[model samples]
Target chain A: MSKDNKEELKNDTIKENQEEIKESETLTEEVLEDIVEDEVSELEEAQNTAKEFENKYLRVSAEMQNMQRRSNEERLTLVKYRSQDLAKKIIPSLDNLERALAVEGITEEVKKGLEMVQESLVSALKDEGIEEVPVTTFDHNFHMAVQTIPADDEHPADSIVQVFQKGYKLHERLLRPAMVVVAQA
Target chain B: MSKDNKEELKNDTIKENQEEIKESETLTEEVLEDIVEDEVSELEEAQNTAKEFENKYLRVSAEMQNMQRRSNEERLTLVKYRSQDLAKKIIPSLDNLERALAVEGITEEVKKGLEMVQESLVSALKDEGIEEVPVTTFDHNFHMAVQTIPADDEHPADSIVQVFQKGYKLHERLLRPAMVVVAQA
Candidate 1:
């Protein structure tokens, strides 16, 4: 009941409360540190996983682009050669006309018909992406002259003088090799 | 300097050493818990990202298969109709053979030549996948009636009385519809 006793009790209560507060603070600090560490690791893992997915996505996208490009090439090829069937169908008509020209035809009407047929054949060949191979000189890329012979001084060697069998081209590709007699050097 | 003082100093040293050990243990436990949590979260996130990528991979693979299937179907259709060009080229030869057959009063040599021509035409048609449309009573699907007339009272209606133009099928598809005369009721 004295002043000293009361002061002593107050000090005791304050010290006990301070210890409890310190323990609670330590526990809270431990839990907070654990949470912070877990979150940091989770974030690091998420970042790594995202990077890996980005790589995979890039690879897949590149593959898709390549496939699309290939498909486009195939489609272009189809369209470019779409009329080849019809052109092939008409070639025999040209052959028959050539035969008629070779035959002995005395009539004027037949001659006119042959000329008309030849013109029409040329038009058809032009229409169907087929044209005569341009091989005035002996270049090896487009023309294949099967035969070679020695040339005179006036005519230059490696020049195309005689064409035995005509060369045919279909859409920038060699359909048949030209059978020609070329000058020998 | 006294024995009591020496003993008290020894006790204080022991207490301080034990406190240091306890502090170290608590710190170590905190560090270990943090590291474990970090490692676990890192693994979990990596696994989740891997799952996402796998699903994407499967989807792309399915798309690739579909594209290939579609392209293959287109290629097969192209192959089935590959001979159309050649058949068209040979059609004129067939017409000429027909004209030769119609010619009358031929010598034996001429007859033999005509037979040879006919044989060649037949063989060519066979090789080119060209077949005449089979006709019996003639359903409308394969035949077009160019003319119609009343049948004999005994005959059934829609009977094929005559075939004017031969119908032809090229690889199971009608190239030209057959012209016919049908009997009407």
Candidate 2:
């Protein structure tokens, strides 16, 4: 072959070798970039899953705490008002005892005995956190105005004229509202 | 240059090109292998994270369910036993009324009124889930054996001879044990 032809063939081979090197380098770089991108996306997905679990755990924990608090409060309220139903039932018995005391035909001795019994019933009620609702003034919250009476000098307007039937309370809750007579102007 | 020298130069260049191409090819293969290894590890990590989150969520859900069931049961118990305290308190009042009824020399009117009061009291107690502990035989659970009597033909051994004081129960709970006289063999 001619020297020129030989030199041309060598240059072409060198150029081809350079292009192959460049292509291989680019391919390697692309593979590295793909690895980095895959790792980043995988990490992000794992992090998102962890974050979602954390949020769910937090929400469930908060709900559990709230339910616990509500249950505790309900239990406390129940304990505090444990005697409410029986205390309310006993009120009518107390009213009967008071009525028996009002009866005029009983002997003094019998009346005295009845008075002692009434006192004991009152004490039993008090021991169980039951008490008469105080109604010096007419308050709609605690006293039920059964009848309205004209205001007098002693009983001003909106004042309690008289309590017809006594009201009772257990703890802070009203067991029975006072059946009362309110004074009106 | 001589023909042999030129030939030698050309062969050296071709050999160098071949070595460079082989090196680049190996580097490219190594990079691809690294990318595949990185992706496999990343995928494993992601699976692990998801498994961990699933376990956490299941545990939290189970705990929350248990707590909810316990709280509901506690609330039900509280409601069921709400009248126990006042029922227990009213026992002594009932005893006093019984004593008053036993007294002699009272007028028939007074006796009738007292009977009515006792009935009302019993009704009230019943309304609040309080009932007398009935004892036909000696049961240690609800009856307190205060006195022992010799067993006769009429009264079998381990039988309740007489009730000195009535026992009462509020729902399933014993409010007061019956003070009784039991027959012995």
Candidate 3:
């Protein structure tokens, strides 16, 4: 071949080789970019999943704690009111004892015996968180007004005039409301 | 230059280009493999974290349910025995009423009133889950033997002769054991 032709052929071959190298490099770069994008998306999805789980965990944990607290409160209330039913049952017996004491012409010894028994019963009731409802003032929540009487100097308006049946309480809860006569203006 | 020298130079350049392409391909493959490994490990880690959170949630849920069940049981027990203390307090009053009845009463009206009161009180107690303990046979669990009487044709050995103070129960629980006299051979 002539010198010029050989030189031209060599230049063409070198250019082709450079183009192929550039193309391969670009292809490798594109492939790497695609792999990187896939990894980033996967990481983001995993992060979102973790965030979702964390939120659910926190909500469920709070709910569990709230339930525990509520259950404890209920248990405490149950213990406090444990004697309510029994205290109600004993009211009638107490009324009967009081009636027996009011009977006329009883011997001193019998009256003394009844008084002792009544005192012991009162103590027993007090020990078990039972107490008489206060009757100095009229409270609708704790007293039931069965009769209304005209207000007087001694019994002012909205005051408790007389308790027909004594009310009892177990702890903070009322076992029975006092049946009372209230004074009206 | 000779044709042979030019040919040799061109062949050497082509060989160098091929080696460079092979080297780039091997590097690309290694990098891709590393990226894939990283993604797989990340996915595994995410799955492990999710599993851990799920396990914790299940355990906490179970604990909360168990607490709820236990609280309910406690509440039921509290309700069942609610009248025990009150019934115990009323026993003394009942004893007093019985004593007054035994006394030689001069008036029939007083006796009748006392009887009516006693019956009403018993009914009230029954309504509150209080009942008298059975005393036909000697039972150590429900009866307290204060004295032992000689067995006869009427009373067999290990049988209850007389109840001193009547025993009472509130629901399934023993409120008071019966103070009794047992028959002995």
- TM-score, first chain, each model: 0.76, 0.84, 0.84
lDDT by residue for model 3 (B69-112), tens: 88788878777776776678777667776776777643565566
Residues B1-185 of candidate 1 have per-residue lDDT tens digits of 77556556655655555565567557757876776676666767776776787677667767877887887787676656654554544444444545554555544444444455445445545555677777678687789989988889755688788877677667787766678888888
Q: If ranked by lDDT, best first, what sequence of candidates would result?
A: 2, 3, 1
Model 2 C-alpha lDDT per residue in residues A1-185, reported as the tens digit of each score? 99778877987887888788788788878877887787778877887887788778778878888988898898888888877777777788788887777777898776766666677778878988889999898888799999998998988999997889999988788888999999999
- Candidate 3 per-residue C-alpha lDDT over A51-113 given as tens digits, one digit per residue, 9 for 90 to 100: 677677777789988987887887777777777666676667677767877898766656665
Better of 1 and 3 by lDDT: 3
Candidate 2: list runs displaced more than 4 Å.
Answer: A1-16, A29-42, B1-13, B29-49
- By summed lDDT, the worst window of 10 consecutive residues in model 2 chain A runs over A109-118
Q: What are the models' TM-scores?
A: 0.62, 0.87, 0.83
TM-score of chain B of 1: 0.66
After TM-score superposition, the amount by which residue B53's alpha carbon in candidate 1 deviates from its true location, in angstroms, is 8.3
| CA lDDT, every model vs. true structure | 0.64, 0.83, 0.80
DockQ of predictions, in order shown: 0.09, 0.49, 0.40
* Candidate 3, residue B153: how far the Cα is off, in Å: 3.4
fnat, candidate 2? Answer: 0.49
Better of 1 and 3 by DockQ: 3
DockQ of candidate 1, scored on C-alphas against the true complex (2 decimals): 0.09
Name every residue pair that clashes in candidate 2: none
